[model samples]
Target: MSRGTTAVIDFDNLRHNFNVLKQLAPSKLVLVVKADAYGHGLKQVVQALDNVDCFAVATIEEALTVRKYRPKTKILLLEGFLDKYELKIAFEQHFDSVIHQQEQIQMFEDFQTNQVMNVWLKYDSGMNRLGFSGDEYSRAIKTLENNNKVNELILMSHFASANQKHNKFNTQQVEKFIKFKTSHEISISNSSALLNHINIADEWCRVGLALFGVSPIEDKTAHDYKLKPVMTLKTNVIALKQIKAGETIGYGQAYTAKTNMQIAIIGIGYGDGYPWSLGNNATVKLNNQQARIVGRVSMDMMAIDISDIEIVDNITIGDSVLIWGINANGNLPLETVASNAKTIPYVLLCQITSRVHYQYVE
Candidate 1:
């Protein structure tokens, strides 16, 4: 109801996605709230997902943040925490930690005498970003297994291209995960795999974006499935101008009106998670009609060429506009916006700045 832009999160949609996942896989669900539920608001998302089996975070600090809201929820620190202090916090706070490196194993080994930990062993498995390589994985698992430091072991790997429709890479990753599974229990499926790779869903699947119904792929959107988006990034038109043909607008004079047109500057822009580079091509919605940007997207505002939108001659000061979300029955997938930005859904979702206000919609 305010004049400025704000992001709206639909818990109903999140619950729907969670239910769809539950029906698809009986395996435990780790609601990936890492990166503030992909910038859908951290504390609010956790509160809405209180029914989830557990939540996963990249760092202990994130886990601790969620702990305040859901004190009893099972939490997994993805591939972080360097030493005993982090582990001690995990132990004391009762969070399941992913033992990513050998040093983390040593930290777990420190508490071996008194604590049996639920640990997911990170196997490099070709991601090569984190986890152990070669025999180091076997040695890490064996070390944890032998010492009783490991109460349960889940093998985890990050897929490089699980979202691609024709990627052979997923199959390759699955085979590698299967190899790790022979020696330990496994948890392999991220969002894309949970939807398309049912073959690997056993053992427990960790889902992040899909739980919020945002896809990683562009050509095929999450809306194609039973999934619906949980976040609606919205804004309002703050200024409007009528100009004749040959009138240039915005920075660098990137756009000049081909004919007399109406331009509306919305309150949301790059600083509010709208990508600046998309000034000329990105689409926004108003009065159920599409509008296109006419100039460079400034840090705090963007102008849309609304020449075709009818019934709105003068820009109503408080008229609503969409950044990347629903307008009527149509919705702009976060995937589409990210694609336009030459990035991915994960980065776009996480980069939503803290300036905008957030409200949870049930």
Candidate 2:
């Protein structure tokens, strides 16, 4: 077991979480594999969730990537019909669309053929990043229906604060969606909505982080539910050194030991998608033993305090080290780790750059 890196993903756990989410909503479960299954590996994660009904993606290429695996899964394009090729692919590939921006309306009209194209009118339920509102939404629905092009219509909206169960905004958004989609079915639910906003699970629950077994709200761990973490982020230790007092480690000299201390350099770092904002004190579990980061995390390395581990020198240089996810205490759940870093789980998972290997475990 080398010291420098470890990322352990549990397919069984991921599947369990997905099942739990499906049981929560009395509607279709739309597994979201966007951002490469939140950096846990796209095809790898999809294979684990073969039982799911559909998937959602942000771009055309992302949808295509998933199509390579589960070719027949119903895919809904949240961003909806962009390029001319995207419009053509939507019909040919049978991918659905969540038409939000006005331009998307023209996208459907310009399409060579809308024979099998299914469209969802995305409404502004609160989170204003996308979707139409008020007269714009009403008109969009009418335009699509009037054109006699779209074969299917579903109402869609993103919740802004479903994580906050007490937030009145969730109720407001639900009301708005009901009024907007009165004549159509709908797809609503992000990770937060499934766990905390059960009251409005709606017809289609877009399971994302929830399926990976992570909580949507701050300070809320998935352990509170029956969910299990799907990814176990692990790394290996590459080197060990005992530095004298006043010695600094890694780049930027972020930590200067006050007394003689032992440090362990880990293989995985920010470049591998480990969050940098977690600071030097971030926790690590090596050989099921707890350790702490002591120096600034470099692009490819992390230093940890290992003076307390028994038989420290006997430990080989390539021992496994957990960067995030379930450890001795239980699932670290990437979404929770993201919150601690003051970011969203979607970004934390998607930021997992490229060229990473995924080892599947049932």
Candidate 3:
């Protein structure tokens, strides 16, 4: 029997989003496929993005996985190597490594051998999460440029407030990155920065959420940017029933029916990567109408208040229901779901578990 839940990946939509970035000429799009393509499945995403300019992953393992599919495409290790062995593997496999700290620079120098390593010196332009301090960045660059094993060097920094649009820090960081560079190529934008129209990065842009058809900016949406969702999470109604007024439902007895009403139990919950915090506030589609979740979400199921939904051919057992993503003519945008869950789309999208079956829609 099927699991009754699945995540449908649309390759065409993925390509459409990538092409959106392609329109910004000269800024090479570094497709960020880290965290298993944001939990959309890594190998499949890599295969679909075969023609992309480059791929960025968070670890050496992810880089190798992408390399297996696209042997010649540029693969960047965003977190760089954690140890000497990984650093050696990066050099031998021709993967670009981002050197974010003085210790990382020291490691690169120590591990220098016959193999050449493509390097990107990370500049800490106020994010303070990673990268060398502004004071040490120049010294780090000079050291790498003098090293014979360093084949190419690029300057890159992360934005702390690109999504804010009006934040002065975005301009400040961009200008700081531009001034910090010493004739090397630069990359200083993510998905949000690319859409802000503030001219963040002209040489390269590392996009993750945007490529997956999600808006990184809070005030906008994927549709607003003409990007289509790539993942549609869906499930089927496992059972239905009617209950009298004042009867409680689910664990914690959080919900009570005010009157006789119909309910539909869906085969989806936090176990399937649905946010449990969405209980009583989440909406699901049934019979082409919206239904509200009635109780706390369980490990493997959730109950929706379909009491007012008129019973029809469209509403029945085995009927498919959209948990999130695009369905019918309506879209359950991840951004909206994230807001309802008191989280960000990045967490919700990446938190999708492996128990759910994935079907690719090309």
Candidate 4:
């Protein structure tokens, strides 16, 4: 049999998470399908959730991809059109664009089109990354409102620290965003904001990680919110070896055995999108037993200490290993793996390389 390095995408789990988020959300849901639906497969996800209120992406191409599958559903460009040509395409595709800068406004004014476009006016608020300053933001609202080319106008802002439930900055940002609110619809809550119960009444919520059955909140797992993991990454043990107490394992000889130990080399590593930085304290589920990682992770494989496993002798080559997700034993939350890798779940999911095969299940 071939190496069993695979990412299983459970559409049922995805739908369940969507329904859970819908119940928690105050109003409309703008499902963020950017980064290929957080590397779960964009086209598949867009088609699976055909009845969602809207699908938001980071690029115009991603929006077009969603439109290709769900022709009638609303698609939004989070970054908006970059130039006159993109602006034209947005109007042609009937995509909602976010106007965050004065330059985008100027492009709208210079363009000649009979078609009207829905616009999301982004305010700087506390996050200095995008959107116009307070003064500039006010002018843009007026400009878009008066422009006959603009159809629906929605006010929006981003949260800098919504993950941190008690951060005072969230309150400050919310207060600033409220000042610009008029009669237009608004979207501000992200996955963290909604999960943290920091949402406003009837505002659109743009959820990404949580939509894919992963938690965006710190110190919490998806199960805590009754969300099931959609992606379960799995691999297999390729080789097993026994080494003496003084022997070291893998590259850099980073891990030295204090006692006689058994090691299993698994057919997955950074090349398969498993984080290279993960080792030592990091663990994987093998045959319902926790196997601690040893030495530095290589490009193709890594070794796990399985000496403590009660069934060490029973585990042979090609035994299935759970990198992260639910199995017969129990669930190994991606959140836990992320913490061990010194990164976030988003990075772990998005960084999955092409070498790893993906299997979608209904």
Candidate 5:
């Protein structure tokens, strides 16, 4: 009877999501398992999705973690090499790298390795974050093409606004990327583009959030794409109390009750990856009814207003409360919680801390 919360992981649902993405577009998928598989536990997720075309991670360390679980599977270092030493290790381990900067190209030029490495040439397109610019793109590509240490070249770009359907920037970026075609493999679509913009062509799709059963499109949901939620964050109501009108709740007296009401204190907080900003706006599920959190979210507990619900009597102390998950009888989706928190689902999912228990299901 630990008051600590638990994160239930459904491996079957994760596999189902992989298949769903593969069916959505007949292309190879590089499941982006960065941020410890979006905080779903990296080793467990990699063990589950080892059959994917490849895996994408943000660091050489993340790539190494995936390599431990998936020894022979192709692992891409999305951030590419950090130094000359890592470049040699990446090749020794057969890890693919993304070349996005001229400095990286210089690093590649400086290194002399007999092991030919696969490289994904990143084009800035319009994100202006990573990847090479106009003439630099040609120089980098030409340099890699001529370098004997480079084995294969793949063209890639990240969409700045693919989630917004009919975004002109999507077309502009795609058009820009198409100009760099060098008969190499191409990958551009993320979860949003794969679900919303299916017309875009690519040999590979780098999917991260969608594989975790979260939708990237603004107008649609995971249900719209036949994806299943893989992670369910659950906790229990430890106590309940009645409050009179004009009384305040939590620190700073943030919430003043307008009327006499009942509140339930759940054992979860920002320390457990629950956003403190979600105090007044977040919703949780109890007996299939939504309960709004009131006042500020403390480090160990938060108060929820259960006065408006019909089954308050039935929701006793020690009863289960769903922080976020998919349920047929009104489970609170992560998207809803994220929307209320004024953030994207990715941030919320990745923010899940290690303090929470992880229960993996086959």
Candidate 6:
């Protein structure tokens, strides 16, 4: 049998999360489908959802990918175009663009297209990332407002600490964003901002991770917000053996057995996008019981300590193992895994490699 490392995508849960997010937000939704819908398969996700106000992506090619599935749905280029060639494609594809830099605005002033383009003017409130700041922000607004090619203009900014509900930076970002807000519609609430009830946007809220049924906030799980996980990563036991006390396990002999214990080799590892940083610290679900990882995660496999499991003796080759997400016994939140790995849910999802198989369920 083939190695059973797989990412099972539940479209029903995806739609459910979308509805939950839509009900929570005051304005329409700009579903962020960048990074292959957070590695849950972008094309399938775009086609599955209906009534999406807009689909936002990081790059021009990703925007085009969404466009291929959603012919008429609005697609926003989060980083906007890099050069005139991409700008031309944006216009041709009717993709909305985020104008955050002086050069992007200059491109608009120089391009000779009769086709009008919608633009999101991103202000660098505090993130100090891609955005216009201070006088540059006002100058860009004036330039875009005068440019004939520019159509609907929306004011936007990003929250640097929306995930931390008590972070004062969130308040500062809102205040900075509000100072420049005009009669135009605005988009400032990312998944964290919307979920945490921070400053909800007036016209649109760009949500990405939350829609995939994973929480963006620390100290919280998606279940805490009534969100169901859409991606359940699973693998299979390929071998089982008993290790004597003091015997080290796997590469570099990272882990030593304190007593005679059972171990199982699962067909998944960093090569399949499971974080290597999780080595010797993370756990996987086997027979509905948590099995501690025993060593450094290898390229195609890892060892799990199954000696303490109640059903340890029952586990056999080809038995299913849950890396994360819902299963028969219970759900393992990606948030929990993220915390253990010293990372975040977004990285875990997006880092999933193509080596793992994908199974979509309605």
**TM-score to native of every candidate shown:** 0.94, 0.93, 0.97, 0.98, 0.96, 0.98
Any runs in candidate 2 off by more than 4 Å, and if so which? Answer: 1-4, 327-336
How many residue-pair clashes does candidate 4 contain? Answer: 0
lDDT by residue (111-223, candidate 1, tens digit) is: 64466667888877678788887688878877877876567777777777777746887787778667766756677777777777546755677888888888755676778
Error of 2 at 68 (Å): 2.4
Q: How far is candidate 5 from the true structure (C-alpha RMSD, Å)?
A: 1.5
Clashing pairs for model 4 are none
lDDT of 6 by residue, 1-362 (tens): 66899999999999999999999998899999999999999999999999999999999989989988899999999999999999999999999999889888888889997899999999999999989998989988888888888889999999898999889999888888888878889989989988899955568999999999999998899999999999999999999999999999999999999999999999999999899988899999987889999999999999999999995778889999999999884578999999999999999999999888999999
Error of 4 at 326 (Å): 1.1
Per-residue lDDT, model 2, residue 347, is: 76
Off by over 4 Å in 4: none
lDDT of 3 by residue, 1-362 (tens): 34479999999999999898788535688999999999899999999875788899998999999999999999999988889999989987899999998888788888758888789889899999999877688888889889998888988899999898899998888878788765788998888887877674458888899999988888578999989889988898998888789999899999999998888899999998999999999898766678899999999999998877766435778888888788772567888888889999999988888899999989
Q: Write the per-residue lDDT of candidate 4 for residues 260-346, one digit (tens) a residue.
A: 999999999989989988967699998787988999888889999999989679998988999998876457999999988889999
lDDT of 5 at 229: 87
**RMSD to the native, candidate 4?**
1.0
For each candidate, C-alpha RMSD in Å? 1.9, 2.1, 1.4, 1.0, 1.5, 1.0
Judge candidate 6 at residue 161 and give its lDDT. 89
Task: Write down the lDDT that model 1 would get.
Answer: 0.79
Positional deviation of residue 348's Cα in model 6 after best superposition, in angstroms: 1.0
What are the lDDT figures for the candidates, one per model? Answer: 0.79, 0.77, 0.86, 0.91, 0.88, 0.92
| Alpha-carbon deviation at 299 in model 1, angstroms | 1.2
